[model samples]
Target: MTGTAPNRPEPPLIAEPLTLPGCLKIFPKVHRDERGRLVKTVHHETYSRYGLISSFREQFYSFSRRGVLRGLHVQLPPAEQHKLVACLQGEVLDVILDLRTDSPTYGQHELVPLDGERGAMVYMPPGIAHGFYACDDSLLLYHVTTQHAPAQDAGIHWNSVGISWPDSQPVLSERDRTFPSLAEFASPFRFHPEGSPL
Candidate 1:
């Protein structure tokens, strides 16, 4: 809610596909003026057209200093989530992994540049795991479709995958660092194609 110009009508969000199926790089419309800028991050009508989950059940953000890396995570079956993640105060090298066994891009990963200043976001389906490396002191916002379910929460170890992190010594939480590597993770989330919602 930092930037708001309610009187003006914002354009619809622009969605671009990433290498992985169901993963998208989104650019919400931003209006600028002599004072500053106004960003419209969500619109149910426009978002739903792209198959994004607009009825977010939870919304929060995280602040990370440079060299901090977080995630490669998702929830299990019956508690999976669709996410719209954005960087609101800095930039990050965002990473997304496709975990759907049936997906053509299964086990494939993609790198996206999320910038706070420019206002970019990523939309990921349930069968994907996401993580990021802060290139600056970044503030990341997360809008998830499902509430947190601790028992179903899970993740793959950061180093297990072949991602080339910007920092070899990124600050990590015990849980993120200790997650099972890609080879050890047994994914329970499944994918549905274009017209379907998982």
Candidate 2:
């Protein structure tokens, strides 16, 4: 005796809208089974197709428990760094701020909900502030265009950006807590008179 069944289709990758001054790049990975599925997180050639050419000099991974908040930071330029960020194990509410005084999106903010289950990557240009709230105990991995420069590192207070974060009094590190508010710090990157990157 045998039972009849209907075939199920695979779900397509979800690419969320890129808020101004922020971009989301999506790559489809082939899935095969019996053993385990394979997923390619990054491919230089594929990234080139999207006009991203900068090579990474450093890579970092951070693991945070739920309700933790990190960042709202940018490195001073010529030390400014570009980033390619992804969620590997759980989920995060990723937020970015356009800090270029001359950028059309200056002072504007964007939010991206990144999930490990949905292979998504965010491209953050230099002259922007980046941060995220751990929606669950999450693992975040990222590639940077420049090496870390402790002297040139700085950040804005996360609450100043106006993004509604998870309500349970976020756990913050001392450094993040001591960071200045956006209005108190002078931007280290130069923006054109037209509000664009110089």
Q: Give the range where candidate 1 is weakest over 10 consecutive residues by summed lDDT.
A: 189-198
Instruction: Give the per-residue lDDT of model 2 (tens digit) for 12-80.
Output: 332333665435555446476888555565667555645554499998999999999999878887788
Which candidate number maximizes TM-score? 1
Per-candidate TM vs. native? 0.91, 0.82
Q: Whole-model lDDT, candidate 2?
A: 0.76
Q: Point out where model 2 deviates above 4 Å.
A: 1-17, 27-37, 191-198
Q: How high a TM-score does candidate 1 get?
A: 0.91
